[model samples]
Target: MSKKFVLIYGDAFVDYIAEDQSNSRFTKFLGGATVNVAAGVARLGAASSFITVTGENETSEFVRNELAEEGVDLSFSQIVPEKEVSGVYVHLLENNERHFERYVDVTPDIQVDFSAIKNEIIHETSVFHFCSGTLFHPIALGTTRKIVENMKKSNVLISFDANIRPLRWSSEESCRETISSFFNMVDILKLTEEELFFLTETTSIEDGIKSMQQYNIEALLITIGAEGTYAVLHGEVVHVPVEKVIPVDTTGAGDAFVAGILSKIYLEGHPSTKEDWIRYIAFSNRLGGICATKPGALSAMPRLKDLQ
Candidate 1:
């Protein structure tokens, strides 16, 4: 049988990353967490389908064209004339870390309609991935919940990445509450060390994971840059380390990691044993590390050739 595609749903943003620590010069690239993942999966030779809303303008055309160039299928996406694609300015800090400085969203209210998503797409999807980017809007939140509910009824593996952006949400409490609402419905959950503390309201990693025990999440992966990833599988915690790399840009590293995990699950099937989970997490860590060594988000994503 032919392998099923990894279905991703979220916004597509034009990232304006600063050229250096001075934060003066900027370069634009096609980005957003879900956009990076969709392209990353396809770069790894896995089938990927993206679901998002674009516009009829030049920027929207660029987003669609770039995604198509990266081998991402846009068959499930929509094009609305009034919808202006969002843009975010990223500032590089010490250690090549990225800080989201400002977000320019002309049409935050526009979102994908869940009811319009065909049932056959859901049936053919081996893995469905989403993030907290669109959850700040009520309409998008409701649509995400509806989509998750439908995916739950199917055999598709559900993946959620709490790609938290404080600038996008009205308040921290609202962001935490909105993201936590989908924890129980997701099969795999990915978070950064900071996002863990923000969501669980805890200072330590152990405390954060302890607080999240109430949710029915199957696998919880907390990515710590350079060191590695901490994965909670079946009730046991395992630390999966990665080879060190001198990172040039950390933007979209987490998205690359999520794409790696979801692609493996889609192409190879879900990891059944504890050992299986560790191997998958380790592979994802390598992908994230490789992405950081480069510059742009989607451009930095490792293709099959990069892995060799």
Candidate 2:
């Protein structure tokens, strides 16, 4: 049977992207890390399913239409009451990186229950992608934890991304504690160098690797912006350099990278050796590099043909 890629994004935010922080004009995109991953996977000709909750508002309609057009399965998505609205995030692009300010006060109303879809969808899932953004919302955290625990019992490979947005959490200490607990369930872990420090409380990559051994993780990917990425598998780490691109907007680049790696591994099965991981990382780097050359997250995500 072909592996099905399932992405859970409880916190689906409408992104208002701006080139200059002071600009009054903003370009909107269906944002959220997991959403980008789902779209990118579909673009790569993979069966990608997205799980999210939104209302009947304009933001929700836009997101729904966009995902449908991308060929992403939204069978697990929920449409809440009209008064409830999706979260909104405003991003400012500078120095090939992104700065975010979010309006998620209304997200509590956009509730989700993973148990509702457990038997119908998640049971048949192969790769379950989980990002830490959902943890920021108390209403979503309970269901998120339940899904992770269930995924563990079902023997599904859990792919995790620490797309940490500290400002959204109650406190940095709380964020660290909660995110650390999640590491125990992760099989394939991906995070930026800074996020690695936050979760592991270590100053260097070597120390971070040592701390990660306590978890169920089989492989770890540490992305160092601009410098490249470090892929660790079976106790060995290999550095993969990124291809250069004149970035127009770096939004969704990391999410695109995750999708690229997932597409390769899902199609061929998980990497067995360091060389295999290196090759996957190189391919992912190219996808991310290409994403940087465009604008918006999903809009920037490259198709398989684009990479070829």
Which candidate's lDDT is highest? 1
Pairs that collide, model 2? none
Mind giving the per-residue lDDT tens digits that candidate 2 earns over 1-308? 44566554556667777756564567878878888999998898888888887778776787889989999889878777553544555566456467776665554645686656657465667678878887876767787888888888877788888888877788889898888888778788898999988888899999988887777677788988677898777667778999777888788999999998888877877778777888888988888889989978888999978966
Checking candidate 1 for backbone clashes, the offending pairs are none
Instruction: Report the C-alpha displacement of residue 227, candidate 1, in angstroms.
Output: 1.2
How accurate locally is residue 216 in candidate 1, as Cα lDDT from 0 to 100?
84
Where is model 2 more than 4 Å wrong at Cα?
A: none
Total backbone collisions, model 1: 0
In angstroms, the error of model 2 at 50 is 0.7
Model 1 lDDT tens row, 120-159: 8878888999999989999999989999998898757899
Report lDDT per candidate.
0.92, 0.79
Off by over 4 Å in 1: 1-3
